[model samples]
Target: MSEGHENAGWRRLFGGDDLTFGTGFPLTGTRESRPDVDEEMRLAAHAEDLGFDALWARDVPLYWPRFGDAGQTFDPWTWLSHVAAHTDEVALGTASVVLPLRHPLHVAKSAASLDHLSGGRLVLGVATGDRDPEFDAFGLDHEARGARFREAVDCLRTVWSEEFPAASGEWGELDGDLDLVPKPTTETVPLLPTGRSRQSMEWLGDHGDGWLFYHLPDDTLDSYLDRWREAAGEKPYAMVVRTELADDPAADPEPRHQGYRAGSEWFVDYFRRLEEMGVDHVLVGADGDDPERGLTRLAETVVERV
Candidate 1:
């Protein structure tokens, strides 16, 4: 909650009440092989050209085949840094980082470095992590994630804002002698806790700079927004929408995994509805065989129209 104005990324994406658009990585997703880094980068540039507000990266440490989905297939920090170098003004973000699995100092250092690298264009979406197998692999207790998440949040805030900050937690103790350098462009990097992250709504309101949530139904979202606004006043709320655009501009929509398959017209109206409901930003994951095509169409019809 102590970031926005000093961070251009936060201002651009979360400043206005009208919903802004951003695209997640893996522009064209892969099935059995790794995604094409070259082409993905190409689309990233094109996305900025198309006026996309932000470029989001996913954090998938190890791909589990049973999950049936490999995330962007890249480490979020390195990947975003690469993305930062390639683009000019477009914001850079993490859809959500698994805080319990990584050290808070590492996260703080990486995020601060990236923020400086990107001209303060980083909005770190953090989570407690959902995959159970990941916890076992990392030698962590699954049930203790909530506590770990809180610790990480505190650690990051402390190290970034205070010089030689002292802290002790599940990760490790940071003695008051050594300090983290290359402090973020702001008092601290903007952190938006994603999903529930094993945390209560009240806690999110208190700590988060903002909130990042997955796709939700209209009725459900409205209800959730009611709760969110009451708890968090003026703090921005962002959500993802999985969409597959159709060739026909007026084509109807059908439910997909966490979103819908629809034409530009419907997508426009859907976004308008979200904007009206007080949604700040919408991270659109182009869901289909050819993501660039869907992206182009969305930019033309939905983004422009909105």
Candidate 2:
């Protein structure tokens, strides 16, 4: 791994198949009537104890009928704080907080609070929200989100860094002294840009600490990484893959989201190929409804193989 990648806890926690395995918190599902919030926290903490690297939550403020993933069942920021107190080692990240939906001041304050409380284990992934229902609910113009998102990013970085930085933009204003107390333990928190979010390639290169993307073919992966290297200069890269595990290692893969349904053997080969391709981190979503069993199987049969 490169020095920049090495310095981020994500590299240590999610670098290779040997030590890098993460299990996501399933907030929205038909499995059970919203398993108690406290119970959810305990399960996530248990994943850390079980040797998982990170636990990711989603920012689904309101369930859009079209995008029907209930999404981790809670307000992302408050849930992160509650989970941070219960777990000691597992890193916390949001799949992405729609940057334009919320106030940057609130976003900066909550993020810094979690970073401080967790001892610098927060990895923030942000995006310009896409769902129309959400945009409507907040009375924000969907078409203008990209511009708003760019502005929000600027405000967040400034609010967290400057003792009293003056920010004037389309979003709002931050005039006068603003401490934005408890700056991240690291000079700045690690940020991963998701789905373009209206940022130009050059802008991403200069500002983004990392990139978050969905799965891609090996060749496409290489191509994107090359572009990222150009923009990233020396930053690391990360992505998400949603796969389904079969009951038997010999079971063939079936199509899931960017990932495939596969056996332990296939999963092992998949990650080995990813590592060889220079992918620093791969966030795996639980394959099935029974996340515990799926995670345990991956840990025992696949990760152990590495």
Candidate 3:
């Protein structure tokens, strides 16, 4: 119902409640290692061929060994642009980008440019920096990220939707004399606020085009969905689930990280349950020795079936 949902990428992902699927980056599940680019590209294209609706890239500005994840080992915008060239139709997403660490001008320009080049296929998920080291490295006060996050959201919307928009913030000042050009392919890109991002549900619901949440227990997730419906109306609800499809179609699921390790049979049922509960999209952090193969298997069994 939002203006930006008119964009092709947004419509593709949230057009229905059948629970569309996406694959997350760091496909190899490596914490400290950089994945092979060629193979990643193959998988990126493969995912689209397999009928996955989107490919998500994470923003890891620096690999804090303590954190143990390097994301995709490429800048989200650049890597997504490369992926945009490799595949057609599938949406491009940032799982998300750390907002407090970068200036909104950069985010606005980069996001708008990607949306332009990708033919309106960009969905920008934004968040406050997750790691304290990133805040220090960016020379920002860690305590002020919540406020900065709000300002950055406003700044991005202002710049993208207005010509020569004037605004001021801790990041910088924008005067009406200068305009940000190459506006997005839609009214503006649909922004999905990642996690809480230090904001209350009311704000996330009011401001974000959608919500990106993490895996949660059944009762907890149901509660979240209920609250989300109340706060966000029919705006989409998307979440990440760790999926590792085993060779046995009947294998049971066990808890891993924020999601589950299960057979694709279970996953089909799992996803249906999510869809019934009003989830619009599900991003799979699929894990395996050969993640590409696992993705294919999941698509064959779960994505197609669900």
lDDT of 1 by residue, 11-116 (tens): 7797765688899887777733588888888899999999999999888887888877667787889888888888998999997899999989889989999999
Write the number of the candidate with greater lDDT, choosing between 2 and 3: 3
Off by over 4 Å in 1: 1-5
Give me the runs in candidate 2 sitting further than 4 Å from their true place. 1-19, 27-33
Tens digit per residue, CA lDDT, model 2, 1-306: 343333244555544544266656672233222546766776787677777778887787788666767677678778788888898877788879988888887888888888888776788889887787888899988899878887888887887768878887876776866568877766666777886777787777777777778888788999988898887775667788876777778887787778888888888888888877767666786556666676767777876575
TM-score, prediction 1:
0.96
- Using all chains and alpha carbons, the TM-scores for the candidates as numbered come to 0.96, 0.90, 0.97
Summing lDDT over every window of 10 consecutive residues in candidate 1, give the lowest-scoring window.
1-10
The candidate that achieves the highest TM-score relative to the unseen native structure: 3
**Clash counts for the predictions, in order:** 1, 2, 0
Lowest lDDT 10-residue stretch of candidate 3 = 25-34
